[model samples]
Target: MSDVIVVGAGLAGLCCARELADHGLDVLVLERGDAPGGRLRTDEVNGFLLDRGFQVLLTAYPEARRALDYERLGLRPFYAGALVRHHGGFARVADPLRHPLGAARNLRAGPGSLVDKLRVARLRRRLSRASLNEVLEAPQVSMAEALRLEGFSREIVDGFFRPYLGGIFLDPALETSSRLFAYVFKLFAQGEAALPAAGMQAIPRQLAESLPKGAVRLAATVEAVDRGGVTLAGGERLEAGAVVVATDGPEAARLTGAVETPAARATTCMYFSAERSPLGEPILVLDGEGRGPVNDLCVPSDVAPSYAPPGAALISATILGIPPLDDDGLEAVVLEQLRRWFGAQVDGWRRLAVYRIPFALPAQPPAVLALPQRPVRLRDGLFVCGDHRDTASIQGAMVSGRRAAAALRGSDSGPSCAL
Candidate 1:
């Protein structure tokens, strides 16, 4: 019998198990999927690595820095700032603070006014310097309200914040808590947005590799989890010293029968293989108009050439709403829009995949933000953790897992549990 049983082999479950195992505890991780990485999985198609969605890791995340080995991931970084598409041209908004530039040129031509850029920089500085507790517990408000309170003009809000940050949080209205905005804003400001050369799955694979031999058991569907232990799909109960439910919010609720899962954010990601590169750099392309089906676009191969086969480019477009058409129909619609942005050259791009994720992230409002995120400690030996329990980012997921391990350590002293 294992000392600890963790349900879900995603980053949270994997990280929690790693922590427990590191402390000399026998940890058993059960995952329903054939492989790990609940939402962060990757697929290989025709020699191209396609992530489940457009996801990137910010190196500034404390948990990520402490838990992950970035060097081994062969990190590929995107160009600083953004490539905002407004009317018929692209606007560049490089980090003036980090990458020194011709201030006059960028101020007059970037997404927002000079004052707006300065305000963004100031907030970014504060986020990078502030303590986690101080930021999370700071007075809260809607992200929109917070931006207005900071005196951001309508131009900057619409051009940069609306499409850019809106796409990130899946909240175009900016109804998310100001604290979340602050946390994300800090990440972007302080660190480069990047992906592993191998794919997002590499992160989880590394975590699982750190565990003991046969520590993780995939294809083990968990029906429920309680103080006693976890029950498999066939009503097989695997009793253990403690149990941790680290699945997504909805699945967690189903297994525990106690959590009221919050509303979730949805998105549609479409991938296309182009004959040639559209944009030169791996910069994020956003629709400032706020009406097109494309919320944001990126050519992953521009930064990490390995994402696509030689001489080909991979274009990923993320839409805020699900497209109401079949794969062929949706592909046609996406290509039509791409032609507008890149001209007639887009005619040669081939559609690769269309992933519409309904539960991309948890809808975190002020109330959800105020809740204490941790082991949750359902009873004496049961607990829960995931990005849903905290912020909806790789950082949050890993941090919540660490919190669960801490709770497990505190609840009982280290020792082997009798079978």
Candidate 2:
């Protein structure tokens, strides 16, 4: 029997287990998957490292800053803005403060009126001054409503925010909470959006490695959870002083007998190999026309050379929802779309992989966004934590994990880092 059992070796479970083990508690982490990363997984196909779905880490996360070593991760940064394809042409948009002289020029020539650009700057300044919790706990509304109320014209909402923010939030309709929108906006303002040079899976591996030897047990599936302990799939039951259900929302509900967990947002990402990159800049390319399945595109090798072998380039395209077309048909459609923007060089791009995640993120609408997020200490010895319990982000997963560990030790203070 262990002092504490963490059922899942994802970022949440690893963080919580590390917290407990550091306090001299015997922590055992069980994972059904062979690897520790849940959705943050990466695989080598031929010579390319492809993440499960397209994802980026924000350096501004308070929990990440507190718990992780950035230098060790070898963080790689993307450009401050994007190249948006609109009206059969590509236009650039960058934050004026970040790019200084050039962003204003792009804003003047891109989509959205001068008034819309001014309102965006004003909103950025207002949110940057607020505390992290203040922004999170603020009253929530739909992103579409927030943009409209902020005095941005519909043209800006559709051409800019819909495709740009929608790619980040995984909601093309902008139905996510304004609170999350503002929080992400502030993060973008404060720090760079980056990826670990090794791949996204490197994050979970680093977190799990900090624990004592034998702390993590892979291929161990928890069939059920009770007050006593968890029952493994092979029929053996391991008792513990406490059990932290750190699985995703659906699996957590299944183990703990909880009902009505939130639904997940879906996403599809396709990886491609090319002779040469269509765009050389490291900025994300957005489909401002919104006339096709492609939402946003990027080349990992453009940002970090390690993602692909020395000579080849790797490109990734993200689609927010599952469409009716099959994988082959979808690729055909996307290739035709790219041909228009980057000329016929796109015809040579080879399909490397396609990843469709139906449960990419927990849905964070207005009500869920407004709910006070804290670790669920089911009882004195029972607890649960995941991105579902917090803000539905990498930060939320690690933060919830740390909070669950604190609850086990009867401490209310989770992380000391302040944003």
Candidate 3:
């Protein structure tokens, strides 16, 4: 029997197991898929490396300093500024450092009315100062209500939050709690949206390498867990001192019998290779006209030179709130939206890959804000970890995993670093 049997091979499970193993505890990781990455994955097609969707690695993630090697990973970055197209015109939303003076000029002279601009500036400052913990614990308020109370106009909400924030959470209704706003602002304020020179999968691959070889079991679907041990999909049973369930929220509930919560929203992404690329140097084109299922488009080659072929461009389209059953429809919608943006280029572009994630992001309602982290003890030998236990990002998953390890070690005397 192993000292610890960690269920799932995602970042959370990997991080938790790595920590425990580093402390000289025997750890085994079981994953249903052939790989370790949960959502941070990549696909190769025709010499092009494509992420499951357009995802940016945040350099400001708190867990990276301890859990990952950012410098060695070759995390190439894009221009922090994004080009936002609204109505009939487009404007450059510059980052603070990239074009500090220019950003000020645009913020002062851009499309918004005097009152609208002032309101946004004030709200931005307030959000920056507010602590997410305070908001999450105090009351469960919606973004719409918060914006209304702050006197933000409907136009500003639609033009900015609807497409931008919606793309983040995949919810067009904008019902996400304002508590998440702090995390979102942190990504922008730190100016750290980037992509690995290889692909997003490099992240999980790096973390997995920290463990002993043969520690992770790929395609080992877990069917049930008991105080004694865990049962595999084919009726194979293995014993362990403890089990850590590191799947997503719904899966965690299924394993531990916790209160049921809704599954995460899904995303639909499509990749196209163009002979003569219509996209420019900037990595992100936000809210471009007719960028429908394609709310945001990014040319990965702009950020990471190794992502595409020598002459071809890698164009990625991302849309939120896709149903698992609508794979074909998602692909068609993304392609149609691409056609609207680059009419002739769309014709010459070759379809590279299509990724439809049924559970791309957990639906973090206000109710979940109050939920404690996953129970580290299910009888004498069980635990759980995932983004649902904390924030629902790379940082959250890693943090949850590490916390689970600390709990299992269960004493300040046993390897202080392990905790």
Instruction: Kindly give the number of clashing pairs for every candidate.
Output: 0, 0, 0
Lowest summed lDDT window (length 10), candidate 3: 410-419
Each prediction's TM-score versus the true structure:
0.95, 0.97, 0.90
Model 3, 31-70: lDDT tens digits are: 9998999888888787899998778777877676567888
Kindly report which residue pairs in candidate 2 clash with one another. Answer: none
Q: Rank the candidates by lDDT, best first.
A: 2, 1, 3
Writing each residue's lDDT as its tens digit, candidate 2 over 1-419 gives 99999999988899999999988999999999998988899999878889999999999988888889999999999998888887789888887788977776776766788888888899989998998888888888999999988989988888889998889879988889998999999999999999899999989989988999999999999998988699999899999989999999998988887634778799999999997888876779988888868999999888877888888899999998887778899899889888888888888899999898999998888977667484468876889988898888999899889988988889867653223
Question: Scored by CA lDDT, what does every candidate get?
Answer: 0.84, 0.87, 0.74
Candidate with best TM-score: 2
Query: How displaced is residue 216 in candidate 3, in Å?
Result: 0.6
Put down candidate 1 lDDT per residue, 33-90, tens digits, no spaces: 9888889999999988999988898888878888999999999998877788876787
Model 3 residue 329 lDDT score: 68
Please rank every candidate by TM-score, starting with the best.
Answer: 2, 1, 3
Best by lDDT: 2
**On lDDT, who's better, 1 or 2?**
2
Model 1 lDDT-worst window of ten: 410-419
Clashing pairs in 1: none
Cα shift from native, residue 373, model 2 (Å): 0.5
